[model samples]
Target: MKSNLAYLHSYKQRLAFISVSVAIIALSIYFNFFQKTENPEFSKLTFSETKTEILPLNIAKFNPNTLSTEEWKALGFSEKQVATILKYKEIVGGAFTSKNQLKKCYAISEEKFSQLEAYILLTDEAGKKQNFKQNKWVKKELIISGKFNPDLYSEADWVKMGFSERQAAGILKYKNYLGGSFVSKEKFKECYMINEENYAKMSPFLLLPSKTPADFNPYKKNYAKEKRIIKYQNFDPNLLDFEAWKKLGFSDKQVQNILNYKERFLKGSFKTLDDVSRCYMISPEKFEEMKPFIKLNPDNFAVNNVVNSNVEMPKQKTDFAKIDLNKITFQQLKEFGFSDRAAASYLAFRKKLGGFSTKDQILKTYNIDKELTQKLIQMSTLSPLIAEK
Candidate 1:
């Protein structure tokens, strides 16, 4: 009986050992060949890149004042730029009439102005209004045959030669803007409205002198000399009528600009010599010649009319006697009797500088007159304050 029990136990132990060995073999086979495994090089895979292309502008001739928002976009103006144009027009009462005026818009860049300059056109009414003229610019039927001198041609002459009223006026205005004569036909081509085709057509009729005088200076001094002796003895720009301004060597366009500048500011009047020079139409040499004759009251001139602008003149008391120009704030500048344009300019100038080191540097401020500089020096002490301090 003992031998039989021992035999049974030995058989059962062998069977259990075989079952454990078969289970180990199956697990090893499954792990080695059938179970799923992750890829090691997955992170190193590359993808095709996508690229963007810039589209060229589709430009066309259109009046900027009347150009729709869509038209402005087609002409390459961004939405922000288009909004700026509309806002500017709304503030200024109408569209731009001249390249100089257009450039004065804060949003318009020099490059953008140059690109769109050729397409700008002022309506007849707008042109006449800006030129300060009441007479209709065009008076005759079309007759496009003539060899005419630009300097000598009248509006009637221009109209007879196929130029529109606005084009004729722009040519005349450009000539006068040069103070009455162009130095060369090439100079005449600089007119914004004078395209290559118009220039080519008018080149044959240009009356440029065959020989420039040996002493001929291109500064327009010779042309200015031919005008009636400047009768502006101690004239006040603040009180002068439009005709009186014209008598002071200001062209019609220039007179309009002066009046516009005066009306655009709070006081709407010239406070210093630098103010006169700020007008784009007035050259430095011209300003110097007229400086001694300029007269302004010690008190600010009161203008009845005020053209609206975006810059809000904050009411702040800035005692010039206690102010430092190098450390002046934008609001303080306005309080110091600077126009909004001039005040903004001062802030920009100071931001670019590492503080002012000398009294002479104050003159470098935009539209700051020598008289104003002298006043500032008397009123406030010039300190050597560095930017970091």
Candidate 2:
């Protein structure tokens, strides 16, 4: 009977221990997850909202075109303002040539421009050109000699070569943003700061490539390396988003130029690989590198073309009298009033069906109509190149 009493007492202690353990576990769960739901202040203690830090503005003489994004922020502009300025410069094809040009940026307030105007250093070439146009100054030539590669020269080197601090900084900034080294002297000349006189002075000392001057076209050859044939990726530039473009190794500036060209020049369309090739900013090598990957869609092209057109007819229809439809690229289709996407679509269709036997086949293409096909038939001819292909 005494043993039975001891066993009962031990059983009670075990039950008490189990109850305490369950209570502790329940409390732990309540604090871990349920506490956040039950207690708002506890949730706040765990996670804080993210805040953007604004930099203090420094008032100094600065070139809006040349300033890095960080430098713009340091000068008191917000991150958004900096991005706007950069985009403005990019759309306008790099660098503000005049004080008035800087004023045109939407982000720049009158008060801000006024405060920064005194500090802004206009390139000597630009200043002189504007002055000459205004009858305020005459231009002259300066001659000098030194061994220098303008592409490789630092800001200090430019300063030693008689450029002002601001001019030197502008040149370096421009080169840095260009994404690659200058392949020729002509490219360096395109700098807003570098005028004919300055170029003449620097030309003798500048190290040039071994190729004949005739061989180096600045617009076509932006890279220093020889062109290598690369296998094309299956993609379409017209349909590519920003991230996709960046993935293709295009510079930010180049990508922006493509977007700008689409909106402004091409009327929000691309008509051909040729149209893309015509973007002088894209070097021949780069275009060739991309030629394989660009897939064109015609339906998208047709819709945009119809929507964007103000005139009764496309402007390039008259120009295609001599162009062979079979021989021409989809870019040529753009001449026949097709949007880039439409042109590409036609080209893609032609490839898939082996070749167009008649203009009637075009009606089967997405977004292509009988009247447009007839007009294309009237405008185009079969070329020997088409037969070969």
lDDT of 2 by residue, 64-145 (tens): 5446888887777889998999899878666555577778899988777776777775444445343445656544322233
TM per model? 0.27, 0.26
Candidate 2 positional error at 372, Å? 33
lDDT at position 149, candidate 2: 71
* Count of clashes, each model: 1, 8
Error of 1 at 249 (Å): 2.1
lDDT per model, in order? 0.62, 0.62
C-alpha RMSD of candidate 1: 22.4
Off by over 4 Å in 1: 1-228, 303-389
- The count of residue-pair clashes in candidate 2 stands at 8
